[model samples]
Target chain A: MLSELDLSAIYLTLKLASLTTLTLLIISPPLAWWLARSKLFFRPFIESLVALPLVLPPTVLGFYLLLSFSPDSYFGAFWIQLTGSGLAFSFAGLLIASVIYSLPFVVQPLQSAFVNLDKNYLEVASTLGFSPIKTFYKVVFPMTLPSFIIAGALGFAHTIGEFGVVLMIGGNIPGETQVLSITLFDHVETLQYEQAHLLSISLLIFSMSLLILIYGVLQKRQKRLNDA
Target chain B: MPNNMLKFTLCKAGLFNFAAEINLAGVCGVFGDSGAGKTSLVRALIGLDEQFIGSVNFNNNVWQDDKHFVKTEHRQIGMVFQEPRLFPHLDALGNLTLAHNKRSLYTIETLAKLLDFENLLDKKTIALSGGQKQRIAIARAILTAPQLLIMDEPLSSLDAHSRALLLPFIKRLAKQIPILYITHSMQELFYLANNMLLINDGKIEAVGDPQKLFIDPRLSLVKHAHSGLLLNVTCLSWDETHAMLQGKVDGQAIYLAMDKPVEQEILQIKVESKDVIIATQQFPHSSLQNCFTSEVEQIEQISASHILLTLNLGKQKLLAKITAKSLQQLQLKVGQSVYSYIKAVSIIGEIT
Candidate 1:
């Protein structure tokens, strides 16, 4: 049912989503924790910057990323000198764009979780002789498992369904940067109704199943807490 | 002065400003009203609140001074919060092992037995009741092998039956480590705390045995509920025949019709002031078993209708709250000899 271009698009999309989700999970926790806990004067400014992707047009963000990754720019030139390849129109460039676009989806949930955490747990943990970092890993992190899962799922799904940002920054290389959304769009433009319908149905099913799984787990956890 | 005792002087602008040199040898009760900053003192003492300018020295090791401050983890202090701050993500066993120090006196097995919650070891902390969670929390704190244990109203969240159940375990644990107990409950104070520091408005108002503070008229404003005399007594003999225990306080004999034997030798007894009756002459025909001649050492009026007669029974002190009519009828005065009658069951509190 699928051609070579379609299969490559699926693989590239999955790779992008997986990499974006993994990188965001590692990068978001400390940033979110700081956003939740720090009292610095610039905290709100940093918070707004993190949340900008949530409200700003994805095309606008992608335009900025495209500009920054161009060969003419300092950062883009550094990337080229180090890696022997230009960042623009590459899978690496697409990955960076997806991460930035999906930043808030990963961060906001984790930030709220950290803010809602009972500080007495940390205090008593310290009194019980657990160091601060050990306390976070052992007690604080486990307690917020539901939020972590929700953040990860949202970030992964959002990256998979991404369109505008990739269109602006990724430049649609057939096997490298052209993801499923671009492929579906290409099928529609060429009047390939069957392929377009297939890709659309698959994306719908994937998104629906991920959402159902996340909500089901969250509801089960809520019921358990209420029963407890 | 042992080096093991904790002494601190903390100064903050608005929230807390207090200083006290505490001899942490026994259950040192931090007794105060709701806004007395007892919790702040605990936070500063444990190094949780570092904004205060102060020095906290324990075992001659400076925890906080002008130049240095030890973090909470290295302080070797265990804390039981007002609520059981147990990890909801972990089972009782897991929570206890989270901060397990290898050199501690207890393992998960022994700590479960110590707190009398062996059946709850495998249960999730969120599934446990308040009392059960508190028991696990205490065991978890003890498993860390802290040099000092700080319990901030650990029983306040529990029901009366639960309080009665967990109090003995707390009493037992106090013998192993010096505890800094913070509570407004007079029952917990009278039962658990021997040495006490009374806090008032972020200051050390008084520091002494709870017994003395209970009767000090100045404390009537704060602890009018605790109108009683505390006596140190020993269970001299247990008469299984009469279902009674022969107790001695200040070398004077006293009898208790207790169904269970007092397991410990020394017992702290509370005789309420209102329960004692004062008579100018001894009643030989009275059915009361605790009638003794005592000399009135002082007299203070506690209220418009009642007078507090402080009586010396041999070397031990006793207080009798009598009506103004009774005082007028008996014409009582200081240094006068009178008979004090207390019902056998009136020793309502006895702590080992």
Candidate 2:
């Protein structure tokens, strides 16, 4: 049987992942659309900046985030003034770190989908007397629904398994910032081999199951579209 | 008259620089060769290409000018593209519903029945054939209740049977609203266009009646093998004994071989220049059943071996292709009366 600490870690991980995924869904669409369609000279520069977390080490990102979230930094000072609390080692700060870490996972799929969309659909919708916003909702959104699902699942799953950024900024605070990965790490470090084995196996099964479920749903949807 | 006219003076700089200024009314057929900038002109007129300079004024409403531009949705113009661009995610009915505005000209049921596609509404768009998809696309455009309908080679991708089936529908729609139809086929031009615009190398070559423009020696259409004229004929009665359709052109009786009875009062028959046989005098004893006494209005040498003759059949004109040797042998001259014999089997009546 798992201890109360392990169960709490699982609950906190789910909560953090859900919130991050929701925030990303709200913000990433416009950003991805712009990246896909804009012709500005500095577009490539912005694209590279968005993709930085994909190649850079997570601890390197965590180190910078830790510095920025400290009480002395300008961002941390502003956040403290607004919320009446320090940002370092806090749930709010941990969420910010996880979002940055999982951004590329959510945004790349959406950008490619937007890029490859058939332009005739937009033109036809316009000729049919639909406004630009209405066209996006009616034509673009439905055509790219599969990409959205993939992006959400990837963002959620990636956030759930995060360890380096959470540890550097969240500081393993039980029932607060401490998540499944960090809990497993703590168990192994304390030489509690039995608990560590149980935690590792459970996480392995859970991640595999999530991925399989998402891919299965996507395949079924593709078949339905083709058959219908 | 200006209030109901479509006038535009547009210019664009690209691989092929395009420039045109014209005031058009009725169903204007835009004819050109491939790469003549027909699609580009349509894009500019419909506000799809923002780089075009100059202006477009449709029915006294300024669609585009130096400072202001109306978006495509607000221009109140319905367009049918070369290909059927239906939404695959929506069924046929759903696609139509998206374009059903408060001012729709016809209800969905009426439109489906009129277009003969009532069976297609519940089917997914991906499963529909090319012709079926195009029907739904046409229905969607009309459902918007636009002021002007623009069809850009809507039948170019369709098969002959589909083309035949859809022509009458388009003709019926033209009676309600002015249409700007783009096409490369002269048959479609003769069947649909009351006014014609000829484009070559991205410039307006001429604009006038299609029947007259088709025979103009300076235009490119005259150089084609199938260049011909359209004659307006009224069905008089069916000759049941001879199994032929009796019709009249310019008060002269004409006969046509048809497998079906005449369903319409007025019909247009295509007469290829090559199919016309010129005789110096009428021969009373011959197998040719239809003959007309026409006066030679003009004669122009088209090639080293061939000459094209324009004959006056009262108010209508007929073109005859003849060899230069025959012209010299017969000593044919302008203002001379000649007998023009057209075979009954060669004339096919086009239902209007």
Candidate 3:
């Protein structure tokens, strides 16, 4: 398997996961905040959509996103004209799929954290002459950082290990779309047990370490709050 | 723009329900039971309750009307909650400075030092004690230098020992700033409030000088804040010779000798109205040693059987709980002269 593969696949895998994790980080905060705080008329509908990926098969999300990004749809045509290409069969396409696949992993914890944040802090902050945005930034946001870290870590690791979603959309373009999970799949299909084992073990270690780090931080917070 | 006068009639809100007309520039305490609209009134006054329909007119500045509403940030008022909601990510100093708009008159260094938060400056909020966090919360509010500040049961979360320690700090802070302090504690009524706004069941039951209300018992709810009489005491030098607490009120010396001793401290003594009796003249040869010459100010009915009698005991006003029959037999009326007998055990609290 090592002899058959080039280094570009490895680089592409790391790049795709990092970029997807970053995009989710940028998008999830306000979405989670709104879901936690807002009472808009359409909030329930929007929340159900954000939660759809959690229960749907990975391939279903990939298929829908593929259609949304293909030239046949209105958005795909408009996006293609602007970006110069349809997103399918490309690294960007795989990144988009991974972000969707990891949506619940990031949003659920972040939303709960926002909801559980000490509300009195907001009241006190408001009375202290802080604007809402300032209170969120100075009070609510920092208190939710640990949750953000958990969301980001789970999202990054989940993306690194994703298979069905990326496979459906990106189609295993050798150097552009092939990620670590795809590489591992390819090795196992070809009966290269040793290379598959190495990749699988590495992914496992990464996920476990991320979870351990989250637990450590949460334990520290519990101790501090109890002592306080 | 004018300072606001907040009027509210609240009952449906889940947290608390009450009504009052709040006039700023002085301490207006909305004292009540824990769930009895104390926090709700504060929330409404500060624009935290969205469903509330109260009008707060600050001089010429009205925060809310029937249709137009001014947001909290635009209200320019500050509040201190029972539990200090200090930002966990920020240290004490950071919490204080975050609200400083630079155009404000107050200074952070002075507030930090005054709140005794200088030592806790770099400490995380989680690292603070209950007392310390409340101090930081108050200092943070003061740093904003708002036109007015509202406090909602701010000391209820604190233990009695902690409340005792912070009362002086709060007294000092409130004097320099106009604060609406809300608490059900009797001590707050006697020690903190200059004016009282009694709210019960979402209505303005009564509003007057706290001392006067206790004497009159205008509303049934006023009993909580007015549970005891307020007697002014000037320290008369600790009686080391007798090992007792000695103080003078209205030129009459009061000696309270327990194992614990403090004689020289300016404070107020609470005399529960129930532990008092009216005598035609000063009597002797009894367990009760506290006797004062007084005149009846008024006698009012508390219940079907009990009558609340108000007497001016020299410079201090005393309340006596007497039966309706006793009042009739003695012919006690307003301005009638008599001697009031107070059992020494009725002093439940000392407000210093």
- Candidate 2 lDDT, B1-352, residue by residue in tens: 4345777777887444444544455578999998887888888889888888888888788988888899998987899999999998899999999888778778999989887889889999989889888988998898899888899999887755567667877877787777889998776777778887788887778888886777677887776433567787888888777778888888888988877677766677877788789999888898888898899988999789999999889867788889999999989999999999986334444334
lDDT of 1 by residue, B1-352 (tens): 4445678889898767787787777688999989898998998989998888989999888999999999999999989888898888888888887868898877888777666789988888878899889888888888888889999998887765566666766777788788899998766787778789988888888888776676677773334533676666677888888898888877778877778787666666667888888988778896787776788987787689998887888756788888988999999988999988886334444333
Among the numbered candidates, top lDDT falls to 2
What lDDT, from 0 to 1, does candidate 1 have?
A: 0.84
* Model 1 per-residue lDDT tens digits across residues A1-228: 888999999999999999999999999999999999999999999999999998999899999999999999998999999999988899999998899899999999999999999998888888987877898799878989999999999999999989999999887799999999999999999999999999899889988998998899999988977775
* Per-model DockQ: 0.71, 0.73, 0.50
lDDT (Cα, 0-100) at A130 in candidate 3 = 71
Q: What's the C-alpha lDDT at position A41 in model 1?
A: 100
RMSD of 2: 2.8
lDDT of 3 by residue, B235-325 (tens): 5766667666777778876776545554325555767777788988677888776777888887778789888887886656777888898
- Top model number, TM-score: 2
Over A1-228, each residue of candidate 2 has an lDDT whose tens digit, in order, gives 789999999999999999999999888888999999999999999899889889988999999999999889999999999999887788999889989999999999999999999988888888887898898899998999989999999999999989889988999899999899999999989998899899889889998998899899999988988898
Clashes of 1: 0
Query: For candidate 3, what is the TM-score?
Result: 0.82
> For model 3, what share of native contacts is present?
0.78
**Candidate 2 chain B lDDT trough over 10 residues, lowest sum:** B343-352
TM-score (chain B) for model 3?
A: 0.84
Off by over 4 Å in 2: B17-24, B225-227, B232-237, B250-252, B259-268, B277-285, B293-297, B303-307, B314-316, B322-339, B344-352
Q: Which one is best on DockQ?
A: 2
* TM-score rank order: 2, 1, 3
